[model samples]
Target: MPLDPFLADKVHLLDGLDWPQVQNDPQAAARLGEYLRDPGEWTAPDVSVEDRTVPGPHGRIPIRIYTPATEPGRALLWLHGGGFQGGDLDMPEAHQVSAELSARASALVVSVDYRRAVDGTHYPVPVDDAHAVWRWLGETLRLRSGPSGPVALGGASAGAAIALSTAIRLRDLGQRRPDALLLAYPFAHFPNPALDADTRVEMEALPPLLRFTTEGIESMVRNYVGRLSDLPPSAMPGAADLRGLPATGIVLAQYDDLRPSGELLERQLGEVGVGVRSYLAAGMTHGHLNRGPSLKEVDRSLDFLAAVLADGAAAPAEHPTYNG
Candidate 1:
């Protein structure tokens, strides 16, 4: 299939700023953050947003909670993606996605501001922060609809990896697990030669704007893993024994470099008899869900999520609809 006309245009319009360069240059990173922080990116006007902190392994972790005005409350614990190096609660990828899901699905959304690798905080730290918040949300907190409302774990990119790991961890510890999972274009696995070869070919066939390089992916993984010799299930969900994960909704972008991994995850879940639903957003690339109000597939994912939480409809869609 050819690239979607609109996304092809978006690719050409890209500023062509390489992520590795931005990470290495402080001024450029700051400027890029500022540019992405535009107030105009905020979406879902009907969702009410609030900021609060929860106890973390070290001090406090910030979180943004989004509540919709009319629907019966279902909750989601969300993490944002930045290759495990960048992103924040107020950023479009983090806040806007949550707000859109909350408003459209009438589900309460909680976005976590977990620690990143750039902060000299490596694998377990970020995962630990997520775990702390997950525990608090399950045990100590109550939603507007009280404590019994269904809560799921979710994230985009690295955040999705974290959510999946958190679910695995909760099951291992004999603690309550989320009712479902919402993973959007997740960075579900570390780089490997076979996967890398396939992704490289797919990326070359698509636009160059969001193409990923093996060197870049390796660098991000090194930053997250540091000197760790063995990665536990908490650090890498793909390395875990995933026999009994919760009902899951996975959204994959058609032209995304990570799409292969997302598909692999869906198959793995199914092989274990774990209920799973996956959406391949045709004509879209990675991070399309982060566009919030600008993309229809984003709403499609939220709709799937609402259905999963309301009633465990964890069956794959036959032919997904597109608003393009």
Candidate 2:
């Protein structure tokens, strides 16, 4: 399928934009935000939201907690994506997704505002923050002992890498793992898997701003891990030992360059005997979750994630794939 007509019509909003420049310039960043902002006039469902900080490796980690009006069904800790350098709790990917999941799944959602890979910051910092929050939640919520409902860990793009890395860290440390994992258009590999011929041709029609060029991905990786040589498997985790990780739910954008990475991860997980559910958001681009739930694909993707959390880590008898 081609780009969704809704997004294709708005492609002009990102004309002449550069991501690195957008990162450094507030005006440029605002323009990119405007282009990614949801155009629908829908409002977020009612959910009690609280802003709080917890101790982290470096300092306090800010997080937003969302609680539904009804009884909580599951507990989720979600992180937003910005190539590990941008994004915050206010973004639709973080705010709207958390709000919707809280209401739709009746889950208690905690959205982390981890430190970005800026200035001299590097890998392990963001992962450390996420791990700290997970430990804190474990202590407060009694996740290890007899507790309330199932708990899930999830994220989008670079944040998904961090979530997986955190899961790996927990496994290595002999800590209790999350009941389930949710990843949305995850960038799990440094040198991403090559796109198929059909996908390559399909991506050629995308605007430059919507494309993740080789140079751009390399730059993002270098910024996050400092030097690209001797890269840590935990930072990317595409080639890491994934055995014993929780059942995973992945959402891939049909038109995304990073889709191959998510697909590869699904295969890798299945090979390692982990239950996996993969969903392709047809006609959507990367970070579609960043758009408001008013978009049909975005809403469906969120629903899939909610269902995963609701189901926990139980391995399905067979892998299930969804095309939204």
Candidate 3:
């Protein structure tokens, strides 16, 4: 099938922009982050945003909290996309998504700025920072009080990878788990050059205007895991035991290379008898949930999150579901 007209226009617009190769270039990553932080490209949703730092294993972790007009007992801890290297707290992918979800879900949204490996922050650091925030939010919100009110966890791309890892860590430590988990086009597994040839070919088959630079994607993946031996189930949940995780919701982009892993994770969760639902955003590419032009899909994702947070109530029937 061809791309949607709106999405095709978006692809054309992106092709005209200047994007540097971030492979081995920290400055390029920084520049990309700055480009994404432009306020002109995003309108702040109607939500109160705050900046605060929480104690972490090595140091303080910064987080932005978004409070909606209608107060609710529940909250969501959100992690932003950047392939575990480039994203920041103020970027639209992080801030705007948090704001919109807070307003639409009527739940407080906490967006964490975990350390990225691209900055030489390294593995376990990002995971540690995320875990710290989760614990702090749970204690702050008193999540153990009841089933109706608990902090949910989620992220986009690399952030989604962190969310899944943190959930596993918490469960292993015998700590309280999140009420639910949400993943948006998550790069949930490490790449296998040999086995991923078909995946790469599929991505390359997209309109030339819409495909990502090979060097750029490879850099993101390399910086994220460093060495293959370092890859653990905690960081890449696709190879992990999925039996004990919380109710899971995944949003996958039809044109995303990562879609296969997201589907695989859904199947793994189902095999373990976990409650899971996946939303395939048709005609969309990776990171569509973060792009301003893809507002319809973004709004739908928020609605799905809100529905999932409502305990004892069934998920709204409108969302297309792939339960596993």
Q: Work out the TM-score per prediction.
A: 0.85, 0.92, 0.83
Clashing pairs in 2: none
Best of the two (1, 2) by TM-score: 2
lDDT of 1 at 224: 90
Q: lDDT per residue, candidate 3, 1-324, as tens digits?
A: 345456554443333334444445576555445533322355666888899999999899999989877766678899998878778998777987888778767778999999999656666789899999988987777654522476789999889989998899889999999888988877776552122665566566454434545465566666766765656667677778877899888887777766777887877888998888877766677787566633566566666766766541235776654232
Off by over 4 Å in 3: 13-18, 21-43, 143-148, 192-218, 311-314, 320-324
**Model 1 lDDT tens row, 1-324:** 556565554453335556575779787576555533322344455878889999987779999888788863677889999889888997777887787777766777889999889867788788889889988876644533343567788898889998998888889899888888888777877653234574456567553437666777777788898853565655757767888888887877777777777878888888898888777676677776656544555557666655665555354344366221
List the candidate 1 regions with Cα displacement exceeding 4 Å.
15-17, 20-43, 140-147, 192-202, 205-209, 313-324
The TM-score measured for candidate 2 stands at: 0.92
lDDT of 2 by residue, 1-324 (tens): 788888888787777778677879888788777777676865878899999999998999999999898978678999999999999999888998899988988888999999999999999999999999998987878744523888899999999999999999999999978989999999999799999998899888777888999988999999999988899998889979999999899989999999999999999999999988778888899989878777888887887888788885342334343542
Better of 1 and 3 by TM-score: 1
Candidate 2 local Cα displacement, residue 14, angstroms: 2.8
- What is the full ranking by lDDT, best candidate first? 2, 3, 1
Q: How many pairs collide in each candidate, listed in order?
A: 0, 0, 1
Ten-residue stretch with the least lDDT total in model 2: 315-324
